[model samples]
Target: MGKGGESIPDEEWERFLREAEAGVEGAPEEPSARARMVARRLREESGRPEPWRGHPPARRQRGKGWYAFGLLVAAALLVVALDPGLVAGWFGGGGGDGGSAPLAVESKRPDQPPPTEAAARRPTVGQPFRGSPAAQWGDGTAGIGLPEARATGWMDKGQVAQALEKSRDFLVASSLDPGVLRGERPRKAIALINPHQRDVQDYLATAFRAPSRENDPVLLFSRFDRTKVRLVGDVVKTRGRITYREGKRGAVEVTTDVTYVYPAVRAAAGSDEVVRTIVRREVVMSWDDPAKVITEPGTFSLVSYKADTTNGGCATPTGYFTPEFGPERAASHPADGAEVDPYDRSKSMETRMREAGGAGCGTATRS
Candidate 1:
């Protein structure tokens, strides 16, 4: 047995037996980690620890003395088997049952205890766990695709957190950039999106297209018209954490609790009408890439997204967006024609909000 499975000391063994026979206090809480291992080994070696039911009726009269002697012999054999040094001492060897002397077993063995959770979760180069004190990326800062992240290790828990952060930044920038919204810089902002995140792509596309019906959600923001509303103040501030787990088939599911804040406007009307909208969004990012390494701009996709408009008078929707989990709606506006749903079979931002609003979601009015 390994050092961790070392035999219990004679005094501890006796005390344990005494307490166990008394039926008052149970065995001492496995003393230490190594002692816990020893306890497990004892169970394996001595069979079950159930009380002896005397040898059938044949040995019913075997005196208590014989029973006690039998137990002592069994304990001695267990000690000799677990610690050869104790057997050596029985024959006048210096090292015996003395607590001061070390066990005759080797201190180190080829098989050591299993890796601890912390050791298993230690972050790799380039992929530092977010805010982890133990993480040490070559550069003070660690980010996706940075030179330091080019390590050979697999992704850790921290990488998932970083990926969510990167994903959020990409989504916000793409939504705010007029060039990307209009077809001018289409692929530029979406470079970080996982290829499989088709629903996310469709969602962004339909959000900026021309409005089809009354209270068109896109109209609330100049319909991606930079001349109408200019993005001002700081970018969206995210306040939330992501929860992730290894999924079936080796996939990873990351749930994000995010709140987004941005200034929307009615610039074309010649009025400085800007409303700060705070949206609480819950979405899932699922990755199914076979690539060896996933960097900041790697293959991670937005599996699903649901956003609720919290700011009242914002004129945006307040319900679910993805058709897979919610309703269905569309639009068609060909450049000059005004009303255009960014994609087919998807709900408008307002439409989603309306659905959620019907469900009793809270509302926040603009100041």
Candidate 2:
């Protein structure tokens, strides 16, 4: 005899206890769906009003098995009520699958400040790149490390290696060289390009001598106006990757995707505020096989170039980048396109270019 005038045979009760004990000892870390459902049902039934409560006792005497069963149900319900996370874990709501786990109620505290606020609070006088992600990046040309070169269908391993080395040199000259950054001609970089590509050379000359909105040298090289801003430190933080693949006409095409972070302050004596300009560039250079393609023997030809500059004035018609210091300065050259996260390099340059449409000013989500 059990509660509510229910009767359970002694043999069935003994079998139930044996099975329950085995389940308790051999259960997996995470409960299965059936186990969760059973636990949930037990919890719900324990909460319901008992029909036999306060009624006259049944004719049959209650057995010890009934009390044991009641105790097991009470214990399970207590555990489920006390630790909600236990229930969540049973239903895949916990962080068992590499997701963030639910924090205990007692462990939670007040929210901290936002990332922007924390960044703004950091000092910049002696630590120009302190709060920036570029702080951990490589300095100058060291970041432009080449990948392992292998022989492709178009070129031998030695040729591929030379082409990669030349591509690295071009990257260092165009982006990391101090003279190039200060609006000087990237002579070394230009010399590496194929001389037969007269149009590119002509464009570079025009871009340097007289820059216009159409032929801005900043598109290919990273430069800043020396008259307005001075570099904070000798080190320019840089990081990115270089890759090569076989192209049409038996040419080995090397592609460089690099980002440079330059920290600067106004040249004026009183200005101690440090501002950073981030430039991300993707350039494609091709080494043409002399027999298969009509190109310079040792030099590479520039196929395409694209760049995105963050913290630069929007649509400024100068060869050098004009860094925006604050809201007052940014207001003068208002950005007009989608917000960009300059530090995020997960997407390719082509994808970003497509998202950006043609050349127009875009707001930087951060510096």
Best by TM-score: 2
Estimate the TM-score of every prediction: 0.36, 0.65
Cα deviation of 113, candidate 2, in Å: 20
Residue-level lDDT tens digits of model 2 in 265-312: 887887888888889899998888778766776688889998888876
lDDT tens per residue, model 1, 1-367:
2366676576765676577667655566444454565567667875556433224434656677689999999999998677654365456432211212322211122133111122122221222121121111111112112111221123555665565556545544444444543324445445666654555556556644543323233322212334434433323333333456665456566555444444444345543434434444555655544553243445466565555543222223421111110011112111221221111113434454554444343322221
Report how far off residue 286 is in candidate 2 (Å).
Answer: 0.3
After superposition, candidate 1 runs with Cα above 4 Å error? 1-154, 157-162, 175-189, 196-224, 235-237, 264-274, 289-297, 310-367
